[model samples]
Target: MSTRAMLFACWIVTFGMVAATVACAPAPVPVDERRPDPGTVVGSPRRLASYPALYTSTSRAERVEYSSRGPAGEPTVVSGALLVPRGEPPPDGWPIVSYAHAGDGGDPACAPSLSPDLRGALDELLGLVSRGYVVVATDYQRSSARGPHPYLDVASSSANLVDAARAAVASVPGASNRWFAVGVSQGGHAAWAANERATDSELRLLGSVSLAPQLDMTDVATDAARGSLSPERVVLFPTLVDGASSTDPSVVPDNLYRGTLSRRTDAAAPCLGDSGAVGTDDARAVPAADYAPATDEDRVRLTAALDARRLPRSPATAPALVAFGGRDSVTSPERTRAAVRAACARGDRVTVLERPDDDHRVGISPEVLDWITALRSGATPRPTCGPEPTSPTSTGPE
Candidate 1:
């Protein structure tokens, strides 16, 4: 080879080697002097798979949408809002509280709305967040495009709530693994259900709070049958009956003559939301006792389920705070007390508080507030229930 060609080849080899060395070199360490603030690290923005595109606005609090893997390859998407403190992040993993709303599948669109009349109850969400705890509220199954809310599908909804919390921690900055689950009315049922079924490895659930929970469907239906019940309560019974019957066929009468069975079966099918041709108003007009399967048969089935105690059987490994209104006619406090006792027997750290004067709609009472404060401060709450005097109160509609 010519001397010039040999020299050029050598130079090319050297350049290639240098390029490779530079490419493989470790990156310079970030300046220690500019290390990220601990608070910032805790509050940094994060993304997780299955989370919906986050929505933020000057007038409204930020919102997130996300999906979770469900049983049997069924993936369900849930939408929720993450309420952070106004200016700074909490020092430790911020305590988290997940709020489950009550009744007829709440509307997710109202999550960030500012109007008090609408879903914009920023105070509730922001209150906890401002107090150094992240607040997450899910739209659950029905709130989004996801159909088949499965309103009473205790296991499914509970799982969705848990998965949403996990997703929130992944997506929100400075979120902590410690969490509390709370719900009122229908939501109260959800809180209890989630606690019963939650796994230790999946959530470090610090506590669960249930307010005026609908504990025994059988009791509620019986009350409605004996007298004039609220249209809402009356309408909800059939759905519960249908769900229970679907899960356990024995809940329905086996010896009912074929004609009677057909009539009752037809009435129960098509679920509340999916009852096509029959309008919501029409469905609501049907009295609980007037349904096809004789009221006695329906009652028999529901009573059996309650006697069998088919509620989520998983024991709550974390502490639980159960509150009920003394005057809650919608859901019997007696039943709630029984549930609290059961939770205690299951070895859960349990606290039961009954506000003698409060009704179903009043938000948390002073005693309940004190209990929450104590829990957040790391005090282990003990179960307590009694007839305390009613206090003045106001809470938004369920």
Candidate 2:
């Protein structure tokens, strides 16, 4: 089918998921605080026959299933895609990029490779493939793995990202030894975690690029505590709690889900699908005061969980390209700045850029490819260890 027809079909699928609410809550699940063995390897990679709907003609997409630890730290099979361009590789091999998808709802069918592209992800992948780069995209453990999807578990997602990179090397030919990471929103946080976690890994992470990453949890809990969260944001608050509660028993969202809020959550699907979160008319009417943590204990738990999953205060081993949208409403520019400030305080090597006109979805400038190219060529990557820069500097090769 034509691209327009294909997109139309995808749109139909997405709109249907907009206001879907599942009955699931994180506090009652049987699993929580379970830690992975970290060294456990349970399965080998297996390839699927069909590619996703948006798999472009420029590259061949291979759907592969591999094992990864779940949010509650259980091991299970997870699925992903490895796209190898159809041409000769550079002398060493194609440089690898692990692309993490943003929130697509907490459902099995939400895996990027299993459905049509969202947010022009296919176009981005096509650009990388056309440039002879190998793109290894993870469906994350929850979307295709054997458990309820892990919405925001940092440890689990980061581990899967590193594993996904390793899986690329093992499952595809002409995959290079060099690896770089690029993530947006939730994926940006994942990229940050991988940045810290991969310091001791077998696969090398040369650097990372995070676009409008969700940085501070203190801010999140504080916002909720003050009931200042917007209606649109209130919709995602449970997801934040649910993800934390799944892995940390202390993080309970039940206290807040007492009445009408519970009904709103019950009606909304996890991941909110590719259409993103849609606030109900009721949800839109919710005052900020109604969005607070149930008790001091839950508030403290949210604080701890946020602290545990936040970006590294110490410098990551590799260089980083950090970007934020000046006008972003979701992962606000201020939060991104705070994270970058903390990173700078620790003497981490990072380059800050701002898309003054873009929102969260269009953060980091399109020159992210340029950032990657600059890193690969070893011409850029300056440290922001001293006084904090007054503002973001747009980054692209000269």
**Best candidate, lDDT-wise?**
2
| Predicted candidate 2 versus true structure: per-residue lDDT over 1-398, tens digit per residue | 01111111122233232222221111111222453233232244333233243344434665565556666556555566677887777787888888777765545444666554533466777677777778877777653223235665776887777777877776567787678877878888878877877764567787788877776655677778877775546766766666666667676667644444554344243335334334544566776556678787777778787777677655677778787779877776877888888887777777777778877775434567777776666555444444333334334433
Q: After superposing candidate 1 on the true structure, give the runs of residues whose Cα lies further than 4 Å from its correct spot.
A: 1-60, 69-73, 105-121, 143-147, 200-202, 221-232, 238-312, 385-398
TM-score of candidate 2 versus the correct structure, residues matched by position: 0.78
Candidate 2 residue 24 Cα shift, in angstroms, is 20
Model 1 RMSD, rounded to 1 decimal: 17.9
Which 10 residues in a row give candidate 1 its minimum summed lDDT?
1-10
TM-score of each: 0.64, 0.78
* Model 1 lDDT, residue 311, Cα: 45
TM-score between candidate 1 and the true structure: 0.64
How does model 2 fare in lDDT?
A: 0.63
